[model samples]
Target: MTASRPDIRTFLCRSDNIGVLLRDPATGACAAIDVPEAGPVLAALDETGWTLTDILVTHRHADHIDGIVEVKRRTGAKVTAPAKAGSAIPAVDVAVSEGDMVRVGSLTAVVWETPGHCADHVTYWFEGPRLIFAGDTLFTLGCGRVMEAEPAVLWRSLARFEGLPDETEVYSGHDYVLSNARFARAAEPDNARLVARMEEAERAKAEGRFLVPTTLGEERATNPFVRAAEPSLARSVDLAPGTEPERVFTALRAWKNKF
Candidate 1:
């Protein structure tokens, strides 16, 4: 007898780092979000007894895609990467662009080209589950470093996410929860919500649990980079109420780059 289609199981591939695994339980077929290391990914698969079927890459950063070849060798999974990032990822079977729909078994994950952390950075959003593989583009409490692009580009990309329903779940590619909480404190010390969340993050780490899949609403409220354009935050950056949103974005990003 044959198993049903799709039915993917999502798990946190966590170590000192983090990634996400999307497994189609029916067929034991799986896909991994940005892989930080081959070891953790392999372990995740071993635990589930699944075969890696595809790699949904978001960017070209080695930390995000370095395990590609190894994972592919172990499972013979096809690879899909951003059109602009295909060259960096070995053996890409499909080069997708923004607005493209990537099918993983019976599930459809939409591609979002979000550049700032890298010119070729992209993200994937699984529709039925409302889960986002945010790569370095978005994190629980913090965002990725503005390494290869301007702060403004990132700001716009983040704004696009703001329009998503508040209940949307976010799964980022790294485990910087505690560190990001610290910066959130500096950005809004008086925000009791931020402080409370920081304590929760500490607890999750101490208990060996993942503190991710934070809601779009929670990030909108406490994420400094996304809220950097607010008048209060702009004032802290020495900007007037009338300052251009992009300028505010720049100041907040500069602060984080050094913070």
Candidate 2:
């Protein structure tokens, strides 16, 4: 890849919201993660002088994929969505699942079935860029609302993200830094890493910087849900001092829901 090559850039479309734009310099084929609002996607396409080649949808939520129709109509871009979500996304060119792979110019995305937020939600992960379009499955500091599944299912779905390299950049549907930080504190009051991350996120957002694409390493260190086994987190959740991992994990998530 050349230095002049276009890249994947995440833009803030609203307070605690994001729209990921993927720029394929080789073909000038731009693709968006979720189309919360068309304006930001159009703005990114305009700025890059590229045409949209595809719209990658994770689920059926309006916030996650309402712009599919307009975007495809305007650009004739293909829409790729989970096999079950195809109905909501008109003219789906590709229906994917856990083992499928999707292509965009020279880029390839592997699909992961992350179904707690919605049973059909599927995250798309690109190789070279090492980016994961997590949608509402995972957030910087919190997981998506467990609307269609149990906490156990969500925990498992989120855990699927654990093996990606520590440097994997997570691009989520929303910028939930502040609320997530508060939850992190309640989950792990004594976590020095969480403390620092909360303050850092506050200052960064205060300065108008986007607070997403948090690395797996950063999340492991600062995210409370992922670190539910930590002693501080167990204590914060009111679990017995030496509670088993399973019990603590359950308690921690319950605590966060209240936070």
Candidate 3:
């Protein structure tokens, strides 16, 4: 599986939002994760010459699903969205929940309900490919804004990914690596890994490159929100030296809101 990785193309849309196209080379089947808008998605599909077979909606956010109807109208793709979010998203033909399997060509993506950014948020994990389309729940060095769940609940929701293989490629819904790196520095200014990543992110953005597809290992080591349990990060944020991980996470979220 590692030798023949799925071909993925990530493009920018709707300001800082991201649109991703994942194609299984074996089957020439492509899946689009979150249609920020129809124009860019259609353009990418046209440029790649890969027919869109599935549209995986991680949540009901307008930026994530605004192009669903148009894309589906054009490609006649099957729409798989979070269960119970059908009303919020248009043209959802199949509603899935945790543990559901979504088959696209030769790949099967397992759904994980990760409600934090919103109650309807979910993530698609392609086990064989080791790729996770983490919509709004997780980002590079940052997590989604908690709008529907308590901070602790969101923290727990994110914790579920702690068991994933380090090599798993994580594709998020936004190009927030630069801003997130800055906030992470505020949390752990002396972290060498974070500092190096910050420099890399700066260069990537300066040259107009995409700053995504970071691995789980990178996130685990340097993501302040994910490493909230570390005493060093707790102290950096002025939390009690031995504060619980969830408590530290809550404080970090509040601080980021103002950052």
Most accurate candidate by lDDT: 3
Candidate 1's TM-score reads: 0.91
Q: In model 3, what is the error at residue 76, expressed in angstroms? A: 0.5
Cα RMSD (Å) per model?
Answer: 3.1, 2.1, 1.2
**C-alpha lDDT values of all predictions:** 0.80, 0.80, 0.91
Candidate 1 residues 1-259, lDDT tens each?
5444444343455354566788765556678886767887888788877778889888887877778888888888888999997578887899999899987776778899999889998888876767788888888888888888778888888877977888888888777889888887886788787888889899988997767778888888888777776777778778897788789878877887788
Candidate 2 displacement at residue 45 in angstroms = 1.0
- Ranking by TM-score, best first? 3, 2, 1
TM-score of every candidate: 0.91, 0.92, 0.97
| Candidate 2: residue 20 Cα off by (Å) | 0.7
TM-score-superior candidate, 1 or 3: 3
Instruction: Supply candidate 2's per-residue lDDT for 186.
Output: 70
- Order of candidates by lDDT, top first? 3, 2, 1
Query: Which portions of model 3 show Cα errors greater than 4 Å?
Result: 1-3
Residues 14-57, candidate 2: write the lDDT tens digits: 55569888877777777888787777778888887778898888
